[model samples]
Structures are given as C-alpha cells and as structure tokens.
Target: LSFSLPKCDTMERFAGRVTVYSVVGCPHCNSAKAFLKGLGLPYCEVDVEKDSTVRQKVKELTGRSTVPQIFFNKTHIGGNDDLQNLVSNNGFFSPQIKKKKKNKPSDLMIPSIPCFTDVKGERDNFAELILEFKSSGIIKSHGSFLKVHKLTFSGSELIEWLVDKKGFEKDQALNTGKELMQKKFFSDVSGKGDFQDGHTLYRLIEHDCLTALNSGKTAECSPVLAAELSEALRRLILKLYGEHLSPDGKTVDYKAMENSQTFQEYCELATQLQRLELKSMTREEKLAFFINVYNALVIHGHIKMGPPKNLWQRYKFFNGVSYLIGGEVFTLQDIENGVLRGNRKGVGQLTKPFSQGDQRLQVALPEAEPLIHFALNCGAKGCPAIRSYSAKTVDAQLKTAGEAFLEGDDGCHVNSCKNEIRLSQIFKWYKVDFGDTNEKLLQWVAEHMADSPKKKELKELLGKGNHKVVFLPYDWSSNSKD
Candidate 1:
C-alpha cells in the first residue's frame, strides 16, 4: 500500500483591517481588490473617481492620486507594486490549508520543525551544514581552464550525499541546495546559471563564509574611518565651491577646476577612499559621506572625461565613471542607485548594482530615502545646487535644499484655474521615491515647499481634488560658467 507525508496547513494572519483606494475603470485597482478577495481579506474600497471629496481625503491621507492605494490598519501601502511587495516580502496576509496524507512509515514521517524558520536561523543551519560538508570531505579544490584553482564541488555530489547520508529524497536534496544558494551560501564558480544537480561546480562565497563564521555578527562602522572620509570629502567639495562655483551655485567652471592644484589634491584624496570601511558608518554618516562623494565625483567625471553630450554618452558617463572604495569599484550609477537608493535597480537597468555575494550590499541603507533626490546634483543646470553635508546636519541640510529647490519656478508651478501642477523632471524620474502616484507626489511637493502663496494655492487645489500633474521638461545643458 502506498503512503504519503502528512498534509500541513499554513495560514497568513494580518493584524489589521485592509482598505483599497480605487477609481472606476482602473484595471490595477480591480486586480488589487480581487487579490485581497482571493486571499479572503476583507477590504473597504473607496472609488475616488466617484466622490471628489473622498479623492481629496485620500490625497490628504496617503498623498497619492492614483487608484489601488492600499492600507492596512490605516497605514499607507502605496499602489499595486507596493501591496505585492509587502505581501511577498513582509507576509502581511497569508493563509493556506492542506489535507492530511494517509498513514506512512516512521522513517518517512515529516518533522514538525520547519526546514527554515527565519533568516538568522537559516543562516546558522546553512553554516553548520557547510562545516559538516567540509568534515565529510565532499568539498575540495578543483582545476578549471587556464590552470585556475577553485574550491568547489559538483551539484550532483552534494545531492547524492544528501539523499544517502541525510535520508532526503533526490528532489528534496536538489531544492535544499538551491535554497542554500539563494541564501548566498554558495554559487556557481563561474558566476553563471542557477543551482543544478549535474556536473556544474559550485563554491562557497568567502565573505558569506566569514560572515557565517562570526555567528552572523554584522560589521560595525569605524568612527575614525568615517570621520576621516567625511572630513576629506567635505574639504574637497568646499574648495570646489569656493574656487569654481558661481556665487549663486548655479554654474560650474569645470575648465578652471581641471587646471587647478586643488583638482590634483582632490584626485589624490579620492584614492584614499579605497580604504573606506562602510560598516563603520552610521546612517547619518553614510548619507553625508555619500552625498558629498557623489557631488564631488560628478565634477571629477566632468573635468576628466568631458561632459556627456547625448543619450548614449549620458548612459556611459553615468555607468562608466568609477572610484575604488572599500576594495570595490563603485560607478556613478552605483552611488545613486546602489548606495543612496538602497541597492534598487536604476532606470534602464535590469538588476541592482550589488548582487547577493557582493560585500557592498552590506553598506546599502535598509530602504530608499526620498530626501536624497534634492541633494544629488548631476552637473546639469536643472539639478539641485551642490553643497557639503555634515553628519549632524545632513537631515536639516537636505530639508533646506528641498525647500530652496521647490521655491524656484523651475521646481514647481501651480495653475488654479487649469487645475494643473507642473514639477521638475526629477520628480518624474524618481516618482517611486517621492510617492509613486500623482497625489502623493503633489503632497510631497506641497509639504517640502516653503511657506508661500504658491504652496497655499497647491494645497487648496489638492484639498479640492481632481487636479492634473505635469512634469516639466528637464534642462540638460551643462552647468558651465561660460
């Protein structure tokens, strides 16, 4: 007689009420509400298209004009992407039921303990397994092309060992290996393909192994290193501002900067960044350090490589410029999308700058900080003004910058009669950072704007709802003092 493993029921429990702000004819809104229903989650849907007052209320509460904005217990959860990300990553609501299997042998009994409970627990178990594998003599050095040496083992060998020694089925063993790989325990030696049960060779990542060895204790930022880097970068930026920037901070004299002794000193100092210990930085320190470095790097790239003149050149300029920091090379794209934006994938990019095994991933912020859009200057006339930031004052400085930028006509414009608001293209490009919807974007703009007639007008329009959003054309001319 055939017998199977016991069936298990897993349920996802949410702690609060679910609400969806929707609009008529919004497919995403419909799908979002449907997803909640499918999961047996009861949600209150507010069709903003029908009620202008409710639309205004949603704009005030969540700062979003888009439909399908979700909330759990009154906490804003953004649009469909935000909802999906929350559900997938945070497990906000989950429920599953499975029927029990027929009687099985004791040897085939399923363990009550979950294979992996949490990230920390999984890492601990994977580390122990690695040590066990080492003791079992399954992992060893192998020769590859060009007489290169790699400490690795075949996928099939690991699966075979698991099936025979650990009593796991072949398929189960294969999946377990893949999970270990996903957790960054090991990877294909050539950095190609996923974990597979074949002759494919895989090796444990050294940094991951070291991390596991330390009992998963994350590295602490060195105060001395952070201070030194910050001070050096600050001095360079200040010197540039004093020497080459226009009094208004709107134009740059790149030609003069390229020929100055200060530029040489700046170049030499940048080399020292190779020793920057990212782990030694606090959030404030990191924000200040990276912002200054990014601004300085823009000037450096402009002088050294010349300003990018077209779309392809702009791509190359952003993606190719690099600095060796902490033994890793970081490009302009790396600083903006990887470091500042918390390792998010940038526009026109398929993946994040830092991969799973990359040491730099440890330096990324827990999430993207929206205020950074105001601090980063891309060496263009339309970009925000450059300024040196201090760890103690970065937050205040960014707020000041945001307010200053929004006060300008180029940053924001309001037309009460037309019910239209025009914003800088920066808002358009990094919409996700701002709020992911027109309503939220406008709310953010209004909030950051200085106390002015325009701010009051925008607020009044938002309060009434049914307004439109337009992104101003970006001025890409070089911020040159010609």
Candidate 2:
C-alpha cells in the first residue's frame, strides 16, 4: 500500500512500496511494525525464518543478519534505529529534501515512537493513571454487556478522562490508550477489538488490579478468617520463594513467577487483604506479615510494572505502587517507613508516612526494629536476600537474616590498616535505628554479627577508638534472573 508524507517544503507528494523483513519473537521487529502502523503507513512483512534463501538474500543486501532490515521502494534503511533516525531528521521523504545544517540532531535526544521501547517507567505511569481513573469514578463495574456483568469502562470515557485530567490532546490521548491496549494493560471486554473512541466496554487485566483496590469494593463473603488469610499468605510466599527465588535470595525469576499458577492464585488472594484486621495482630505477627508482604509485593510490582532503572524510577516505584489491605492502600514506602519503621520518615522524605489522625498509624510499631534492615529486600542487587517469615519464628528468622547479611561483603568490611570500617548503605540510611552514632553503630554491628573471623576483627576495631565509618554505595541494579 502507498503512504503519504506530511506536508514539507521540498517534497509535495511521496509514495513508496515499504517492506519489512522480520522473524517471530523478535521484539525489535515488532517495534518497527508498530512504528510504521502508528504513522498510518501500511507495509508488507516477510518472515525470513521461514525460508533460508530469503534470509541469505537479506544478509547479503544489508550486510547484517538482523531480521528487521527495512526498505523503501527496495532502498535499504538498516534496522529499527535507522528508520527512527531518518524519520526524526526529516530525511525519509525524498533525496532532494535538504538537511538543515543548523538543526543537526542533538546527541542527547533520542527519537521516540509509540510502543517502540517497552519502558517499565511508562507502563507504571500508565498503570497509575488508570488507578486514578478508577478512584475518580470514571471506571466501574455497574454496566452490563451482553447480560453479563464485568468491571469495565467505555473507550470514550477513557479518552475524555485522559484529555481532561491528564492534559493530553484528543489525538494524543487516543494514541496513549492504544499503546496501553497493546501492552495488555486493558482490553475490550469481548476480547475482539482495539481501543477506540466509542462505546466499547474494556476491562483492566487481572494483574493490573493488584496495584490498586476497588474504590469502595468490599468482600461479599465473610472476610477469609484472619488466621486462614495469614496462613495462606505465608504459604504462598514460601511457595514463591521456593520456586522462583534463588537459595540466597540474590536473584529472582520474575518471568517464571509471572506465568506460574501460584502467582495467579496470589493475585486472587491479595484481594482478600481488604478484610484483614491489622489492629488485632501481635507485634511478632505484624513483623512476619509485613516482611513477607513487602518482599512479595516487590516481586508483584516488578511483574506488573518492570523493575526500576534509575533513582527517580525507584522513587516512583517505592512510593506509587501499592496494595489495598484492610481498606487502606500501603505503598512499599508506607510498609517500610510507616509500619515497619514505626511511622518514621524514610530516606529522602520530608515527613512521616502516617499522620496522627491516619488509621494506618494504629498499625505502626512503637519503635523501629533494627534487624528489619536485613529482612527487607527492595529487589535490588545490593539488597538483603529474600525469605519467608513466620510469626512464630520471626524473631529467630530476623536474627538469622541480620547475621547472613552482615557476613556478606555487601554488608560489612573492616580495613584495620586504615583504622576504618566500611558498611552497607542501609546502616547509613537508618543509623537512628542502629544507634545514631558511629560508635554505637559499630557496637550494634559487632554484637549482632555471627561468630566468625570478620566478626572478631570488627569487635577488635570497635574496641579501638578513632575508627572512621564509610558506607558503601548501594547497588540498585535489578536482581532479575537472566
């Protein structure tokens, strides 16, 4: 099919036979096709894997074995990157179109196309936007489609909300909704159509619902008895750790967890959290429950929105993504700094997580537990290992966790020659919980460490005064299984 270029000074009319060489399961190939479709251009796609001869021809012509070698009227255009660069530079329409010498493409600016990169940040941002829609009463389950009840909203309503609430132009909002649909964020209720600006009912996927609870939805059945719910959460986390997490908890198979039946069950079970009575739980029970929930929630967040890539993304991830429990929403930041840390302000925060009037404050511990630094895993390479905690054995479990983390190079290191000790950044961030001073911090570390040569050295160093404390840089790389 012929395609026309937007109005340009030099090129009045343009049409070309666009073709794309592709293969199954190639992400870049799919992106190239989406880019073309977004531009309203129709192209012929050839699967090179089906025939050796065509594959050889492609390699010979492009001098590359990549599947997505695009062409315009048989003129080679390299791969996905080349197509984007050509378009962004306004050099795709004609040879006679002069490139402006003064307006060279900026090295810092990368051309972006809709659905080009599966950026976890954008997915997360979109998910939060959808949650906002739900909270604003824009999305509801009150409508019936084909005599069957479904949690859904109309496409026009979504587009309107995006435009009015998010400040997106009508066209931009439509494209944004389409991108969300392609990413499986939501789908037409009948499972047969793309997102459109019309009265078509669409439902958010099951996994997306984990991030936010229904605005006023409560359990129809008697709350799964607290005992049963607690036990189920414990068992589910244990199963998840056994099947998808490494023995040391440094690596996680999030991809496998995403597809497992256990995870799906966990998602279904999370809804029951709304009915839980947190005030009745003992401190030990709260410790175990919050720790398990925190670790599992990190994995759940990763599966729903990809792992955070930078400090800002991490900030959004820890503060934005959450689960609705006991009719309250608890973000990763809330559970850690609010409940587990006794409602103290977390690192880089200006105020406490829970206010005096907030209901969540009732669940906060009287004081921060120091050992929790070792039990809480933030899905980062430098974070402590993950393990299932049981209320009956939580104290012992946390002690073990603290000991295990201290033994690792990432946790503590002593350089006697320099009269200094290097410790995990966790100590620096929550030094108040540890002791609030270098001497006290060292003493606490020395006392809690397991009996080992390093522990002995740390103790000796602590006894001797004038030792400098250095906190190692925390690694924020994803602890994902390759």
Candidate 3:
C-alpha cells in the first residue's frame, strides 16, 4: 500500500505526541516509516543529523543519539525491530492512511528549488505550475517526470521573459540556455528548442528552472529526458563504488566528494560554459557531465558511510540501458571500478594513510553504512528503498541512507513467530559488527525485541528445543548495478 507522510500544518499533531526521533544514517527509519504507513499512522520524521532541532530533542528524550526512535500515541515505539514487534502485535497505529484521496495530475510534484541566492529575484511560479501536473493523476509515481516538463517549460518561459522583456541577444542567450540544461548534468530535451538564443535557456534553466527544480528536477523529465537523465546519472555512480566492489566484497572506502562552500562557483562554471558558445555538447559531453556528478556523489556517499540525499546515487541502478565506459560499453560496474586506478581508494585520492597519503586537507566521507545497506534500491526484493533527494553531497546522503538502514527490517528480520531469527546476508558477510557470533547478533536483536512477545518467541526459538537459527538467503540478483 502507498502512503505519504503528513505535511507541515498537520505536523504538530505528530509532535511529542507521536514523533519519531531518527538520524539519517539508519535504515530502520524508512522501515519505521513503512511500518507506520502499514498501520496507517502518520508520523513526523526529523533527520537528527540534518536538523539540529530534532537532534537536541532526541538527545533530551532518548539520552542516546541513534536513529529509528519512534514515539507512538505517546510512548516510545523503539527502533526497527521494536516497531516490527509493534506491528506484529498490532500496536503501531490505528489504521492505514485514509485510502489516498484521488490525486490530480497537475498536483503531481512540486520541484523544491534550493534557496541559493544572495538576493532572490522574481522566483518562477513553481507553486502554480504543480497544479497543472496534478490535474493530470500523475500521483506521479517513480521520478516526478511530470514536473520535468513543467520545469523545462517554466525554465524556458522565464528565459524568454528575461530575454524579450529584459533585452538580451537571442543567440547568446540560447547557447547559455543549453549550457544551463547541461549543467544539471542531466538532460533538458524539451526545453532545448525553447532556449535557442541561450538567454531563454539560461534564464529558466539556471535562475528559473534549476533553482526551482532544486533537487527535484531529475524525476520530472519525459521518457527521453528520463532515459537520458538516468543514463547521465548512472554514469558517475561508478565513481562512488568501493575498491573490492563485488557482491561478495566487504565494505570498501568508496569516498564520494566532500561538501564545499563553492556551490555558487559551480553555478558560475555553468554560466562560463554557456558563454563559450560550445555548440550543443555531444552525447559524450552530456554523458560526461552526468558521470562527473554521479561519480563525485558516489565516492562521497561510500566514504561518508550513509544514505545518499538523492536516491539514485545511493544504489547503482541502471534500469535497461548500458554505456561505453573506459573502453568498452561497460555496465555500471566497470565504470564504478574504472574510477579506481592504483590504490584501494582510486585515482585522485591524496590521503597517505588512506589513498594518496595526504590527510591534512582531507575530509573523509562521513559514513555510508546506512545507504549501502539500506537506501540504494537494487531491484532486489530486499534492496534498500530509494528516496527523493539527490546524493550530490555524500555526507548528507550517507546520513540519510544510514537512517533508512537502521529503520528497515532487511538488516534484522524478526521471525513471524517472533521466536526465530532471519538476519540480512550483510550480517553474515560483514560478521565483525555482531562480535563474530550469531549468538551475539541474536543478543543484539533481542534488545530491540526486549519488551515484545517476539522476544519470548525468539528466546524460545533460539534457546528452547531447536537451538537452531535460519539464515535468510540474501537476494543477490537485482539492484540494476550495471
């Protein structure tokens, strides 16, 4: 069943009464979300890592700063397994969301533009535009593609108004427009023709479109744009991969890029590229830009050890297309590995103890334990759930991913009877976390299941007659990694 969270106005109803204290790096957060959804109970999710307010509140409430901390009608629902037990015994919520009210296509999706201006100009009317898509039933599944068309149009219209109403050369503006579209490192097919003078494209894509679309633009493009964007997006995902990136490999330090104060600088670079009159960049150029962003983000996500803000970079998903990387038209895997040249870290690493051996100026990726184990969707039955944000900054992405990890049941599956255990294959592959013993892992799982009837069942299952454990086989087949 599909369920969206409660919005701002109604959020207070979820506060101390039933708020969930979660950090971004835990997968259990997502599962908590899903669990709550299953029970039809609405909750307010505060990313403790991202939101200081929530962090402070959580520390005061739980005394600990971890994630997937849930508060029911008023009591603490605990973490993933805790919530799972709540679900098993029927205590998580009162009901599922009143069957989602029919949605309008025009209300499909609203691009949440990143507020990055020193002084805001006439912002493109993003709010009004959404009504159009929602009027259409695009409850807008998957990536908000419906909004992409509007983004393209909105960007183009803004650019046109800027050029015609503001007096800019048509040719230069059009080229500038192309550059802006290219800058997303994503495709801008529909808006291509509209920004011929470069100015139109520039005005809308940069000031109007990109800003308005913020992190939401990628999901709204057309099939062509979607294909191009996904391909472009996947290209760089390779960069974030680990040294030993095998289904069977242990966690590798796939350091994604670090956060910088030079975000505006990147925007300027896009403008410069536009002014260069670099005729429509070739497919290779487009692909290159996408890869550049994807790789940078992936590397950052891996090293940070958390969830990617954007869902795509969290997991390596290459739906149906394949691209030529390094030399061959490598699937996502080769491209990911291609990022690695000499050391375990990859080409540009300079940290001595780590990769290049230079640690002074280094800002290691935070922690990706969350996303790798949870957020990135791999089409696998149990792969992590991809989110709405972009994994542009690995640190932020990893934190969000981590939140989802600790919150989901995938990592620690409590049996139907609550007596036995079925943990993720990751626990087996990376057995060190559990003190090198199933008993230890079982002990840990028992903590979350502490007050539940499942605890009795689990203790009975493992300690009683059988004295046996069933290791749930992981789904190694999907994730569209290639």
Query: Evaluated with lDDT, which candidate comes out highest?
Result: 2
**Which regions of candidate 3 deviate over 4 angstroms?**
1-16, 21-68, 72-74, 80-84, 87-330, 340-375, 384-393, 396-472, 476-482
Candidate lDDT values, in order: 0.67, 0.70, 0.38
lDDT of 1 by residue, 1-482 (tens): 02112221221133344556664323456567656665666665554433344554665676444456775543567776666655543434432111111112122222232221111111234556666776678777667576654457889999999899889998899999998776455667766778999988886553323211111221222213554565565566556655776543346678888788877666655645543457768888888888878877777888877888788998988898776555455788988899899999887889989998886888888799888988888877778755546787678667767876786679898999999998999888888888978888888888888677888999999999888988999888886666
Residue by residue across 356-389, what tens digits does model 2's lDDT show? 7787888889999999999888878788755546
The best candidate by TM-score is: 2
lDDT of 1 at 12: 19
Runs of candidate 1 with Cα error greater than 4 angstroms are 1-224, 245-251
Q: Please, what's the RMSD in Å of model 2?
A: 22.5
Per-residue lDDT value at 336 in model 1: 89
Q: On a 0 to 100 scale, what is the lDDT of residue 51 in model 1?
A: 38
Q: When superposed on Cα atoms, how far off is each prediction in RMSD? A: 23.9, 22.5, 18.1
Better of 1 and 2 by lDDT: 2
- Please tell me which model should have the higher TM-score, number 1 or number 2: 2
Q: Model 2 TM-score?
A: 0.55
462 in model 2: Cα distance from truth in Å? 1.7
Q: Please report, as a residue range, the 10-residue window in candidate 3 with the lowest summed lDDT.
A: 101-110
